[model samples]
Target: MLLKIDVASTVPLYQQIHDQIILGLASGQLQPDEALPAVRQLADELAVNMLTVAKGYNLLKAEGYLISDRRQGTRVAANFQADAVFMQALQEQLHQLTAAAKIRGLDVKDVQELVAAQYQSFEGE
Candidate 1:
C-alpha cells in the first residue's frame, strides 16, 4: 500500500496513515488478508517515527480493520463487518459533514451527488 502523508497538513501523522489505509481498503487497492509492512519498515519509508506508524496500526487493529500475530505479522482483516460502534461513529461523522455542507450553503443535491460519486467510485473494485 502506498500511503501519502502531508507533513504540512494540520492532521496528525497517525491519523493520515489510518485514513489512507481505510481508503485503500475501500478502493480495493489493499486486499483482504494482505500483509502490511512492519511498523518500523513503514516508518522508515514514510520518514516518520516508528511510534506514529505503530499507533496507526494499533488503532486499526482495535477497530477490527487489521489483525497482527507474532508469526504472521499484520494483515488486513478478512470478512470485516461494520459493527454497531463503527456504524454509530460513521453516522456522527456524516452528521458533522452534512452540517458543514449546509453551513457552507451547499445544496442538498450537490452534496448527494458528491456522495454518490464517491460511493460509485468504490463499486466493482
Candidate 2:
C-alpha cells in the first residue's frame, strides 16, 4: 500500500493516514488479512511519530476496518465491509462535495456527469 502525506495540508497527520488506508481498502489495493507495517516502521516511513500512526490504526481497529495483535501484527479485517454508518458518512461527503460544486456554478447535470466519471474511473481497478 502506498500512502501519500501532505505535511502542508490543513488535515491532521493521523486523519490523513487513516483516510488513505480506507481509500486503499476501498480501491482493492489492500487485501483482507494483509499485514500493515508496524506502527514504528510506518511512523519512520512517514517521518511522523509512532503515536500518530498508532492513533490512526486504533481508530481503524475501533471501526472494525483493521485487527491488531501483538504477535500477528495489524491486518485488514478479514470480512471488512462498509456498515450503514460508513455508507452514511460517504453519502454525507458526496452531498457536501456536490453542494460545493453547485456553489461554484456547476449545474445538476454537470455534477452528475462528474460523479459518473469518477465512479467509472474506479471500475476494473
lDDT of each: 0.96, 0.91
Model 2 TM-score, all chains together = 0.85
Evaluated against the true structure, the overall lDDT of model 1 is 0.96
Kindly list the per-residue Cα lDDT of model 2 for residues 20-80, writing each as its tens digit. Answer: 9988887889999999999999999999989999999999998889998889999999996
TM-score for candidate 1: 0.94
Inter-residue clash pairs, candidate 2: none
Model 2 lDDT on a 0 to 1 scale: 0.91
- Ten contiguous residues with the weakest lDDT in model 2: 116-125
Runs of candidate 2 exceeding 4 Å displacement: none
| Candidate that would win on TM-score | 1
For residues 1-125, write the lDDT of model 1, one tens digit per residue: 79999999999999999999999999999999999999999999999999999999999999999999999999999978878999999999999999999999999999999999999989967
Index of the highest-lDDT prediction: 1
